[model samples]
Target: MARLADYFIVVGYDHEKPGSGEGLGKIIQRFPQKDWDDTPFPQGIELFCQPGGWQLSRERKQPTFFVVVLTDIDSDRHYCSCLTFYEAEINLQGTKKEEIEGEAKVSGLIQPAEVFAPKSLVLVSRLYYPEIFRACLGLIYTVYVDSLNVSLESLIANLCACLVPAAGGSQKLFSLGAGDRQLIQTPLHDSLPITGTSVALLFQQLGMSFLPFSMSSCRSL
Candidate 1:
C-alpha cells in the first residue's frame, strides 16, 4: 500500500484523466447558479484538472477547468446561506460484459447553532468518489476474472471508514470496532488541520492500508 502523501499525489494525477475532465465538465454544466447580493459567502467554486507538475502560481498556465455554483434556495431571506452540491463521475475501463452503476447519497445536517448563529440549517451532500471509482474498476476487473466480491466489499468498507473521524478516542466520534479493534478513540484535535498523512497513519495503526486510486488518464472537460 502507498502512504497517504503518495495517495494524494496519485489522486491529484488521477484528476487529470480524460474521463475525469468529462465528468467535471458535466458537473459544472449541471451546477445550479443564482445571483448573489454582495455577501461574504463565495458565489461558487471552480475545479480544474491541471497537467502533472503544474504550478498554481504560474502565469497564464491554462489548466483544465470546472465550476460549481452555490445558490440560496430561498433568495428572499438575507440570512439564509446557500447549499452546495458536489458532482463528479468515474469511468471504469476493462472487458466487463455488463455495466454496473452504484449510486449512494449521504447527507449531513448541521444546526445553525453549530455555526454560531440562531436557527440556521446546513446540509452537506457528498458522493463517495473512491468507492464509486473502485466499483467501476472492479467491474472492469471482473471482465478479466480478476475481481472478487470480498475485495470490492473491503474496498467500499475502507472508503466508508475513511469518512470517520481520524482520532484515537472521542465519545462524539463513531467507533468501528469494540475493545482492541477500536480504531478511533478520540475526537480529531484539529478537524481541518488533520493531514492526509495523519489519516493514513491512523488507519495504519488500525491494521489497514491504502493504495492509490490513480486518475492520471482523466482529462478536463
Candidate 2:
C-alpha cells in the first residue's frame, strides 16, 4: 500500500556556506529533526501514509517520509523544505463533570514541521547535492555543487516541478525502506524567486498534498 505515487527524489548539498539560519540549520542536522513528540517516521521528506496506518509494516511496502530543504541566505533568497505528518484525534471526556457522563478517547498526534518550502536563491545556488536528501531506498543518491551558476533547463524545470507523480505519467519516487543501499543519484546545473511567494506561504504552513503530478497519476502503486 504505497501511495502518493510511491515517492523518491531527495537531493542534497550545503557544505557550509549559505546563511540566514544557516541553511535551515544544516538541513536539520542531516535529517534527524522530527518534532511533535516524534512518531511520524520518515526522516527527510516525502510522507503520505494511510495503508495499515501506524508507520505501516510487513516488510515495508512503502515507508520513507521526510523532506527538509533549506537555503535561506538571509531573506528573499529563500530555500527551505520540511514535510512530516502523522495525525489522528478523537478525545472527549465528561464522566460526571457536571452530572452528565462522557467518555470518548482516541488520541494521536505527530505533525512535525508538517511542510514548509521557499525555493529560489537560484534554486540554492543551482543545487547540485544539497545532501542527496539523506539517501536510503534503492539507493542512488548523489550531490556535488561547487559554484554552479544555473540553467540545466531551469534545473530540470524546477526539478520537474518537485516530482511527486504516479497515476499515469509514472516516475516512481518514495522512501523510508531502511538506509544505505545506494542508488539515488543527484547532480544538477541550475535554477527561483519571494522564494516563489514564500512557496505558497510554506504550503499553507504544512497541510500539503496540493496533488498535481498530473493528478497524482490516478492512483495505485
Q: Evaluated with TM-score, which candidate comes out highest?
A: 2
Position 30, candidate 1: lDDT: 16
Range of the 10 consecutive residues with the lowest summed lDDT in candidate 1: 2-11
| Residue 53 in model 2: lDDT | 20
Per-candidate TM equals 0.19, 0.19
Candidate 1: tens digits of C-alpha lDDT, residues 37-101: 33322222222222122222212222122222234455522211112212222333322343335
In order, the Cα lDDT scores of the candidates are 0.25, 0.27
Residue 143 error, candidate 1, Å: 13
> What are the runs in model 1 whose C-alpha is more than 4 Å off?
1-50, 53-154, 161-163, 166-188, 191-221
- Lowest summed lDDT across 10 adjacent residues in model 2 is found at 187-196
